[model samples]
Each structure stands twice: as structure tokens, then as C-alpha cells.
Target: MDQEKVNEFLGRFVADLAATEAAGSVVIGQRLGLYRALAEGPATPEEFAERTGCHRRYLTEWLRGQAAGGYVAYEPKTGRFSLTEEQAYCLADPNGPNLPAAFLIALGMLRAEPRITEAFRTGEGFGWHEHHEDVFVGCDAFFRPGYAAELIPHWIPALDGVDEKLTAGGRVADLGCGLGSSSLLLAEAYPRVTVAGSDYHADSIALARKKAAEAGLSDRVSFEVATAQTFTGTGYDLVTMFDCLHDMGDPLAAARRVREALAPDGTWLLVEPNASDTVEENFNPVGRLYYSGSTFLCVPNALSQPGGYALGAQAGEAAMRELIAEAGFSRFRRAAETPFNVVYEVRL
Candidate 1:
């Protein structure tokens, strides 16, 4: 081995260990509202402890860790720490755009590591429902801001003539709706449209119901415990699947179900991870992020079910278009995309 390359690899290993611990700290701060509290102002460890009523020693160590990680600025002279405006926006404010909620997703994955490891050794699979509770919660939280920022304002409008149909009280079925974030957003945005959100996870459906009630959209948006391939009700003017199709056990069957459920002139909007059919083309930060989840969650979930076609998270546009075509949908086109998602429009 080249000594220089060996040294570089060793340095990366050390950095990775620190990064892993840093992510754990981030999750703790996020869950305990430490970041939120500190965003109020610079505080000595004692002051932070007093304000938050947390243990003094714990806050002290956490503060030092955060400062060392450059997440919080340390005032060595005063032994205080503070968050910059950008840090506050990204770490403290959950409602803000740059919020970092992936730590929660990481926590869920870490919690599932044992099962994932077992599955890996046994050549078996694990269900999405088998993940830590935070997996769905974190996923919903992580994607909520983007959906809120884009879905109705941009994505919905981007679909050809679907906006008018929705405004005219056309029905929508959001398959694999998770916690119903998109469904609730749609009902809120288009007063005339009736939205039905469905998920295979009973727990997620229960949470979705609670969320709809809290959003005061229970009247217009209803959630049901149903899978994409077996969801009831038809004549939907629009059907949506967000960041979920690839993880499906039988995405082809799901596509066919979406087809049968659609009205003759209906639209199907698929929002999947931004990647390419070619693995070499997907070698980037976003692709790396998706592949990590695919290995631990998406692939396992798909394999757990009957269908062996685990398309995985990096299923890209080409694969998706081909799958939709195979499902008998004639018109499929790339309707819209962001750096993070690829949105396709399907029409019968």
C-alpha cells in the first residue's frame, strides 16, 4: 500500500468516528431543545443549565462538544457559547427551511442497526414498520419543510392542468402518504379538493389521523390504513407517491393500481430521490445520502415483502419511466425536479 494513501485513509477513519459522535450529540440537542434554547442567546454552561433545568455537567460537556464541532461558537474569554444566525436557522428552528432533521433519521437507523445486521447475515428482510418510531417521525419532519416550501406552490402547479382539476374539487389519492404531510398540505391549499392519504403502516395512519385533526383538515383530508397495491376508492383526478415508490415491495403492481384508480384524464405525480440509472453517475453527496438509507431501510423493506424487485432508493428516472411504462402507462415525462427529488408526470 502507498504510505501516503494509508495515512489519508487513517485520517478519514478518525474524522468519521468524530462525525458519528457529533451526529449523536446533534440528535440529543434536537430532541432536548438544547439548540433551541441556546439560539436565544450566548450562555455559559451554568446559565444554560439553569435556563433549561438540565444537569450542569451534561450541558457543559455538550456545549464543549458542540463548540469543538463548530456547531456553536465558543467564547474562550467568557467560557460561553453561541449559535450564529445560520446555525440557529439550520439547527434550532424546526419550521425554518435549512433545519437539519436527518440526525433523527440517523438515530432511527442506528436503532435499527441490529435488525439490519441480522437481515444482512440471514439474507432475510425487515419491514418498514419494524423501524424505530422515530424513523417515520423523522422522515416526515425531514421532508415536511420541502413539501411545504414546494409541493403546492411549485410541484402541483407544474403538473399540466392538474391544478385546475384540483381547484374544481377533483379527488386526490396520495399513496404511501406516511404521516399525511402532503395530503394535509393539499387539502389546506386547495379548499375544493378532497384528499385521501393511505399508508400500509397502521401506526403511521393513526398518526396521520391525529395530524389531520390537529391541522383542522380532518373534514377534507382523511387517512386510511391501506397499501398502494390495495387501496380502495377510485376516480381520483390525481395520485401522488412521494419518496416511497422505490422502497415498495411491488412498485410495478402499485403503479398498475394507481393506473386503475385514476380517472381517464387523471394525473400521476411521482416524486423520487434524485439519482441516475447508472451507479457511476450517482456518485455524489445526495446520492450517497440516499444510498445509505436504501441499504438500511428501503432495500430491507422491499425484500421483506413478496415481490423480489427491490428497486431501492436510487431507482432514478430511467428505471421509473420504464417501470411505469411496463405497468401500461403510455405518457410518462419528467415534469419537474429539484436537486433532491425527481418529479415525473404520468398520464393515461
Candidate 2:
């Protein structure tokens, strides 16, 4: 290779290593509650140790790692560590509006390391049905409410006149609904609409039911144990798959079934992590993050076989249109796009 190419390759290698090290900093800070402690003010390592009940030496090491990762500020003169206002909002306050909960959830999937290897080798997802509990339990509290109270409000209205489409008496099916947040939002928004939340995980279904009941939405919302590939409901005015399309083992089959479930004028909405337009572009940091993170859980099921879930990186907008057309949909349109997601509205 030319010297310029060699330099580019080496730079990427170093960046990858740095990213991996940064992941450790994230996990340790969260586990130690160091981010929360640093939210209020800069504290001497000794003061932080006293408050968090950890040895000063160990806490100092942890603080230094966070400082190196740019997640905290360290002052050598004062022997103190603190979170900047940005970090405080993003990491310190668990319930803060700017919390990085979704990013953390993706990171936690790294626990499925060995299983990721098996999936890569076999072209199948390993132990997803078995590890569903650990996966969801680690993320539900942070992600569920954030999706309901924040993301939905911002994205749902962006759909092409979706408010007028929903008109309060339509049937709405939430495919691969995790913890029922999106369904609950729809149910709460349109009191006359009946929302059905479906997932392959039984525990998730139970949790969804429990949450819907607790929210006094049980009358308008229901939960079911169903997989996207085999979902058989019909006459739905609208169907949504939120960040869950890429988790289906047979996305083509699921898409076909989704098409079948829609009324003649119904809408099928597919939402997933945004990927770039080419494989080379997929190697970018954001793409690498999504691709590597998916290996442990989503990508295996998504990219399991040909015609399965194609990463947007490898298959761009044109490919998505083709996939929808192949699934028997009459038309496909980019309904909306967000910072990290794209929403495609498919019509039957």
C-alpha cells in the first residue's frame, strides 16, 4: 500500500483500541456511581472516597480513567475530579433529560461476548431467547420512559401527518414492542384507539401488560407474545417497529407478514439505527459502534441469512425500497429521519 494508505490504516487501528478502552471507562464509572457523585461539585479524591465509601487509591484510579476518557475533569493542583455541566447532564443524573441510557444499553450487550462469536460463526443469533431477561433488565428502567416521554413526541409527529392518520379509532400494532412505551404513548394520545404491543419475549409481554395496567391504559392497550416473522393480525391502520426491525431473524418474512397485516390503506413504519450508504462508510465510528454492538445481540438475528435484515450501511435507501417492494408493499417512502434513525413508511 502507499504511505498515505498505510497511515490511514494505522490511524483506524489506534482509534479502535482507544474506543475499546473508552468502553471500560463507561462501565466502571456507571458501576461505581462516580458520575453521580461528581454532578454537584468538584471534589478532592479523598472527599469523593469518603462520600462513596471506597478506598481513595482505587477511586483515584477510576477518576483518572474517566478524566482520560473526557467524561470528567481532573485538576492536578487541587487533587479533585468533577463533571462539566455537559457531562453532568449526559451521565451524572440518572433521570436527566440528556442521559446516555440507550448508548449504555448497547454497551451492556457486550456481556454476550462468547455468544457473539458463536453467532458470527454460525450465522445465527445465540441465546437471545435465553438471555432476554438480562438484556432487558439492564436497560428497561432508563430506556422505557425516555422512549415514551421524549423520543416519541419528537419523532411521531414527524411522520407525514400521522396525527390526522391516527384520528383516535384506528388499530395500531407495535411490532417488537419492548416494554410497551411506544404503544402506551399511542394509547394515551388516542383514547379511542386500541394499541397492541407484541414481542417474542414472554417476560417483556408481562412487563408491558403490567406497565399498561399501572398507567391506567389497560383498557386501550394490550400485550401479546409474538414474533415479527409470524405475526398474523390484520386490518391494522398503522403498524410500527421501533429500533426492533434489525433484531428479527427473518426480516423479509417479517416484512411480508407486516404487509399482510395492514389494511389496503394501512401504513407500515420501519425504524432502525441509521447507517451510511456504503460498506467503507460503515467502518466509521458510529457504524462500527452499531455493527459491533449488534454482534452480541441484534446483528446476528438481523444479518442471519441472505434477505434477512440488511444493515443500512451495507444496503442504503434504494435497498430498503427494494426490500419493501419485495415484501408485497405497493410503495415505499422516507417518511422521516432523525439523528440516529430513519423512518420508512410502506404502503400496501
Candidate 3:
């Protein structure tokens, strides 16, 4: 290799090492509530410590790290730290849609590092049945209500003719339904449509049943313990999977199951974490972030090859279409696209 090129490579490697250590700063700041406190204006380190109930020395160290990582700004003369308007939007305001609750879910996965290690060694996920129970213990109250009250109302209508189609009773099933958020929303929206929420986790089914009852949709919506691989219930007009297909070990098998369960002309909807449009797109910063996050959380389940879980190659639209077709779907089209996800409607 050229000497100058070699030197540049080493320089980049050293910078990557530094970045890895700083990666946890965002999580730490969020857990400490420091970002929320500094949202309005700058504050002296001592004031920040008082506001967050932390020792001044510890606050100073944290602020220095955050500033160095570009998550916060610091003024040496004023001895103060502050969040920019962007930071305030993304991290501080609880009501703001920019808030990073996804990171909280990511951090929760980190707590399962030991399980991840075991899965890696055995080439199997910790098992979604057990994992879901641990993951959603306290998550339902926030996820179900938040998505229904905020995201669904705004976004679901964007699907072409979806609102009109949902007006009358239409059969809907939420595959890999966590706490029945999507199913409950559909149940609440269309009193006539029967919605079924299914997951491999027994605890999740129990919780989903409880929430559906509380939402007064017990009659219209039901919960069941089922895995995507073996899921079988036919004659459904629509089937939906939200933020879950990537986590399955056998997504194609699950997709096939969904196809078998659908009405002859049924629609199969999938919402998954965004991937790049091409291999070159993965070079971009945002794409890199998405890919890294999936590696740590989403794609590993596929790699593990457990029952019901199938390993999926990281891919974009073309790759997704191929998988859907392999699963026996006749046609596929993009129903919606967002910065964070891609929604597809496949026809049976």
C-alpha cells in the first residue's frame, strides 16, 4: 500500500476507537435528564448540577464529553452548557415527535447483552417468546397509547384508500403484534372489522388481551399466542406486521404464512426499519446509523436462525420484493415511505 494511504487508514482507525467510547454519551445524557434541563437556555455547570441533582464534578465531566461529541454546546467564558434548538427538539421536549424513544428500546436490548452473546454462540436468538416478555413489561402503556394518539392518526390515512377501506368492517390481523397497538387502533377505528393480534410470547398475548379489554375492543379484537412460522388463519382481508418482520428468523416463511392466511385478493402490509436504496447508499451517515442499529438489534434474530426466525440479508426495495415473491406473493408495491421506515403492500 502507498505510505500516505496507510497513514490515513491508521488515523481513521484511531478516530473510530474514540467514537466508540463516546457512543454511550447520548444514552447517559438521556438517562440523567440533563438534555431536558438545558433545553431552554444555557446554564453554569453548578446550576446544571443543582437542576439535575448531581454532583458538580460529575456534571462538569459529562458536559465536557457531550460538548466534545457535538451533542451539546459549551461556553468557556460563561462556564455554561446548553442545547441547540435541534437538540431541544430531538432530545428535550417530551411532546415533540423528534424525541428518541427508539433509543430507549435500543438501550433495553443492550440490557440483554448476555442473551445476545448466548444467541450468537448458539446461532439462535434468546427466543422471541422469552425476549418479548422482558422487552414489553412496561412498554405497552406508552407504545399503544402513544402510537394511537399521535402517529397512527396522522400517518395511517396516507395509505391510498386506506381510510375509506377501513371505514367499513375489514378483517385485519397484526402478525408479531407486541402489545396489540396496531390491532387495537384498527379495532377502535372500525367497530365492524374483527382484529386479531398474535405473538409467540404468552405474556405479550396476556397483556394484549388486557389492553384490548381496557380499550373496550375485547369483542372486536382478540389476542393469541402464535409464531409467524406456524401462524395459520385464513380468509383475512388484510394482514399487518409493524417493526417486526426483520426480527423474525424466518421472515420469508412468515410471509408465506401470511399469504396462506389472506383472502384471495387480500393485502399484506409490512412496516420495517429503513434500509438503503443501494449498496452505495450505505456509505451515507444516516444509512450507516440505520445499518449499525439493525446489526445490534434487528438483523441478529434473523442471523440466529431460531424456530420462526429466519436470517435476512440487509437489503433495499429490490431485495424485499424478491423475498416477498419467494414467499408466494403475486405482486408487491410500496404503500408508504418515511425517513425511518418503508411500508409495503403485497398482494396474495
Candidate 4:
């Protein structure tokens, strides 16, 4: 091996491991509400401990790590730690983008690394429901903000006539609606419509139901335990699959089921992980995350059922159009997109 290249890779490995450790610290801070406490204002370890009821020594070390990691701001003169506006948005503010939720999901995957390795070697696969509850919780927290920021205002409006239909009154199904974030969002946004959130994980459905009841949308928004291919419904004016199509073992069948479930003039709004159509086009940070997430999580879930097509989290717009077309959706087009996701509109 070339000594220079070896050293280069060694540095990269250490950097990656450090980032992983930082992610672990992020999870801890999220779980303990340290970021929320700090968001209130600058504080020394003792003051922060008082704010959060955590031990000061442990809090001091964590703050130092966070400061070194550049996640929190530190002052040499005041000897205090705090969050900048941007950092507070990403970490402490739940109404904004809760990116730490993604890190929490990564932490859940780390716990299943051993089983995932065995599955890789043995040609066995795991399902989404097979993972720890942390995965579900993280997913809900991570995706909910984006849904809140865009679902009705941006995504639904982009689809022709769908918004008007939902506004007037309609039946909607939100497939794979983890924790009812999207489902509840729709029900809250469109009072005239009824939203049914469905997922195969019973635990997630239970939580979604609880959330609906908590939101006092129990009558307008309901959650059921079902998969993409097994959700039983008909005459749905609109159907939504949010960031979950690539995780289906049989996306084609799921697409067909949605088609059959929709009214003849209904719209199917499908959201997926954003990716370029070609492999070489996806050589970026987002691609890296999606590829890693696919190998460790998404592909395994897709493979858990028959076919094991393993479309993966990086399957791009081209792949999605084909899937929709195969299900007899003649009209397909790009609806809207963020750096992290792609939205598509499909209709008969």
C-alpha cells in the first residue's frame, strides 16, 4: 500500500468516527433537553445544570465536547456555552427543522449493526418494524417539521386540483404515516377532509392514534395498522406516501393498490428521498447518507418481503415515474422538491 494514501484514509476514518461520536452526543443532548435549556440563554455549567436539573460536572464535559464539535457557541471571556440562532433552530426548536432527529435515527441503526451484518452475510433481511422504537420516534421527529413547513402550503398546492378537492371535502389516505405527523397535519390543515393514517407497525399506529386524540382530531384523523400493499380503502380523493416508497418490498404492488383505492380522477402524491437518476450523479453528501441508510435500513426492509427488489432510498425520479406508470398512472410529473426529498404527482 502507498504510505501517503494510507495516511489520507487514516485521517478520513478518524474524522468519520469523530462525527459519529458527535452524533451520539447529539442524541444525548436531545434526550436530556440540554439544547432546550441552553436555548434560553448563555450559561456556565452550574447554571445550565440548574436549568436542566443535570449534574454540573457531566454537563461541563458535554458542553466542552459540544463546543469543540462546533455544535454550540462558547465564550472564553464569560466561560459560558450557548446556541446561535441557526444552531437553536436545528437542535432545540421543535417547530422548526429538528435535524437531531436524524441523528437519533442513526443511533438506532448503530444498535442494530450486528444483526444487519448477519443479514448481509446470510441473505436475510429485516423489516422497518423489526428495529427498535427509537427508529420510529426519530423518523417522526425528523420528518414532521418538513411536513409542517410544506405539506399543505407547498406539496398539496403543487398537485393540480388536489388542493381544491381537499379544501371542499374529500377522503384521504396517508400510507406509512409514522406517528401520524403527516396525517394529522392534513387533518389540521383541511378541516373538510377526513384523513386516515396507515402503517404496518402496530406500535407506531398506536402512537399515531394517541397523537390524533391529543390533537383533538380523533374524528377527522384516524390511524390504522396496515402496510402499503394491505391498506383497504376506496374512493380516496387523494393518497399520499411520504418518504416511504423506496422502503416497500413491492413498490409496484403498493402503487397498484393506491391506484385501485383512488377515485378515477384522484391524485396520488408520492414523496421519496431525493437522488439523481444515475449513480455517478449522486456522489454527494445527501447521496452518502441515503446509500448508507439504504444498506443498513431501507433495503433490508424492502427485502423483508418477496421480490426483495431493494430499490433503496436513493432511487430517483426516473425510477419513480416507471413505478407509477406500471401501476397505470398515465399522468406523472415532478411536483415539488427540497434538497432532502422529491415529490411527484400521479393520476389516471
How many residue pairs clash in all the candidates, one count each?
0, 0, 6, 0
What are the per-residue Cα lDDT tens digits for candidate 2 across 232-343? Answer: 5799988988877666656778888888888888888777777766668777766766676565666665564445454432345766777778888887887777555677
Cα lDDT of model 4 by residue, 125-199, tens digit: 898888988899999999899889988789999999988999899999999998999999999889999998899
Report the number of backbone clashes for model 4. Answer: 0
Badly placed stretches (over 4 Å) of model 2 are 1-15, 94-107, 122-124, 132-134, 138-151, 302-314
Error of 2 at 143 (Å): 5.4
lDDT (Cα) of model 1: 0.90
**Ten contiguous residues minimizing lDDT sum, candidate 1:** 93-102
lDDT of candidates 1 onward, in order: 0.90, 0.73, 0.72, 0.91
- Order of candidates by TM-score, top first? 4, 1, 2, 3
Error of 2 at 267 (Å): 1.7
Query: Model 3: how far is 8 from its true place, Å?
Result: 3.9
* Candidate 1 per-residue C-alpha lDDT over 116-235 given as tens digits, one digit per residue, 9 for 90 to 100: 888889979899999999889889988999999889889989999999988889899999999999999899889998999999999999999999999888989998898999999999
Which parts of model 1 have CA positions greater than 4 angstroms off?
Answer: 98-100
What is the TM-score (0 to 1) of candidate 1? 0.97
Candidates ranked by lDDT? 4, 1, 2, 3
Q: After TM-score superposition, what is the CA distance of residue 265 in candidate 4 from its true location, in Å?
A: 0.9
lDDT per residue for candidate 3 within 1-348, as digits (tens), equals 699999999998887766666546665766677788888689888888778898898788878887886878888898888998887876777654433454455555566778777766776555444443324643453344445653356546655555566676788888888878778878777778898789887888888899888888898898888888776578888888877787777777788888889888677777765677568866776677666656556666566555454433246777688889888888788877766567787886
